[model samples]
Target: MKTIHKIAFLMIMSTQLSFAQSSEDQKIMQLSKDKWQWMSDKNVETLAALFDEKSVFVHMGGSWGKQQEIDVIKNGGIWYKKATIHDVSVNIIDNTAIILTKMDLLAVVGGNEVTNPFIVTEVYIKKDGSWKLGSLSFTKTLSPSGK
Candidate 1:
């Protein structure tokens, strides 16, 4: 009788833990959407809040720090007029999460305007009960001409 009671208690505890984790994952996805909206509106202040102090930004051109990303946002480097996301997959690992997706950005690059599609990988980390982006990597999908 004692062993059966203990087993039941352990099962209940595991189920509760799984439910809590699922809730957190949902929140994380919502966070990503919030960040995307912030970027789409060119709201630098709000987007800046999404990145952690020790975050990394990796673009096809180069890698940048949190401040660099903020500077670009403020300077309109990305000029993210609009964006669309597709085929997204999110995975959680311990306190870390990874999001991969195909993204299309209507942006201005170096004085020329264009719409570019890229494969993006975003990493987020949970710290002090809050989740913030730890890293972002993007690989441009080029045309056959490689332009």
Candidate 2:
């Protein structure tokens, strides 16, 4: 019947859309992991290419622009020693993706090594078919102390 045909068409369309969204999620997730690696390695050049010119980074200590963030990493103001992700979830809306990751972060800030649990929000925007980091905000779940 006509009702059956319409139902089947809708189902197919829904599945196709889900697949597309899943693909985007995977791409963004991979990029996020790569970004963490770049941070750990202090690869400011790669991060500069990935970060939007007007991107913002928020930390417990302060918030800064893309260039300032790059400078901090390059100058060793804060060293991202390691990140152990506990969970990560991603949501994609049109050309933008929002990712929330809970992790245990080990870092050396101001010459002191510390560890803390944090929830990091990372925003990415698709531009010219490539994703660029728009913003990164880190919320500490617990106060950092010597690990």
Candidate 3:
């Protein structure tokens, strides 16, 4: 009887942990979506709050820091028009969260509109009980037509 009680207690704890993780993941996902919206609308103020001061952004064109990223977005250098998310997965380790999203992005860069599939990796660090984006990297993926 004691063994059965132990097993049940463990199961309950496991379920609770799952729920907690799920809630955390949902918050991160929503924040990611909000970031995309802000980028599309050129809302640099919100992006600045979300991004850490020393955050790194990697793109095919080049890599830059938070301020440069904000400038690029604000100046229409690399406008993120839309992101069609194909799949998104998140992994949390201690206070760090790694989010991988596979999506088709419609962007305007250098005054040219382009669509491409990419795997976007976002790293968030929990500081003072709040999450701040530390890094974002976009890797181009092969399209269905091999483009």
lDDT of 2: 0.92
The best-first sequence of candidates by TM-score reads: 3, 2, 1
- The estimated TM-scores of all candidates read 0.80, 0.91, 0.94
Best by TM-score: 3
* Superposition-based RMSD of candidate 1 using all C-alpha atoms, in angstroms: 3.9
Candidate 2 lDDT over residue span 1-147, tens digit each: 999999999999999998988888898999999999999999999999999998999999999999999999999999999998988999888899999998989999999998878999999999999999999999888533211
Model 3: ten consecutive residues of lowest lDDT? 138-147
Residue ranges of candidate 1 with Cα displaced over 4 Å = 1-18, 142-147
lDDT for 27 in candidate 1 is 82
Model 3 error, position 100 (Å): 0.7
lDDT of 1 by residue, 29-138 (tens): 78887787787677877777779988999886899899998888778787667667766777999899998767787777666788878777899998887888999887
Model 1: what TM-score?
Answer: 0.80
**Scored by Cα lDDT, where does model 3 land?**
0.92
lDDT of 2 at 103: 90
lDDT of 3 by residue, 75-129 (tens): 9999999988888889999999999888899999999999999989999999999
